[model samples]
Target: MSNIQAMIVNVRVDNLEASLPLYKELAGDVEVMRFPYEDMNLALVGPFLLISGPHEKHISQHATILVESLPLVVDALAKAGAEIVDEPSEVPNGTRLVARHPDGAVFEYLQPRA
Candidate 1:
């Protein structure tokens, strides 16, 4: 069985300037890592990952799970009736796959390259 190494709860916001301070306050002393990718500013606040940008279409909250094996996890999710929204793609830190469960829950799965 593929194990989950890390789990991240993603929160999408319209105004980064307005939302950042709230997350900063909620996370307390945890350092937030700012990652700029595809015109989106992602703030990693402990277990909470905040994504904010100008794109209105991509403004929705989701979850990400770092799995040991991307292919294995994808296969398992597929068996459970999760439709793959985005194929595995190379990101800055690793490969990412997006899928939507039958219950309409969306999730992103990551397999970091060693």
Candidate 2:
């Protein structure tokens, strides 16, 4: 039997070029690397996605996108209609923020900046 392991993640973006900076800024140069796909005509980055081209029913189905900065992410997503699963608050000695995607997928944006 083949071992089942979770690998890779993708997000469909209406404009890949525009979203690149966000991921770049979020995950500095060292954290991410990009590959060009001309024949396929797509730019594939690391686990952080920057897919451009089209958005259809098949894409954007069920996904919970998480960002690194909890407080910043929560405020930003809330402005974009992300349902507040929980506010950005401290827990024990750390902190975390939670939110839900439109499709009901829950995401916890964590920042342990250690």
Per-residue lDDT of model 2, residues 75-111, tens digit only: 6676878887666675432365567766676664546
Model 1: residues >4 Å from true position, as ranges?
Answer: 59-61
Q: Candidate 2, residue 10: CA error in Å?
A: 18
What C-alpha lDDT, on a 0 to 100 scale, does residue 3 get in candidate 2? 23
Local distance difference test, each candidate: 0.82, 0.52
Clashes in model 1: which pairs? none
Q: How close is candidate 2 to the true structure, as a TM-score?
A: 0.36
lDDT for predicted candidate 1 compared with the true structure: 0.82
Could you tell me the C-alpha RMSD of candidate 2 in Å?
Answer: 13.6
TM-scores of all models? Answer: 0.83, 0.36
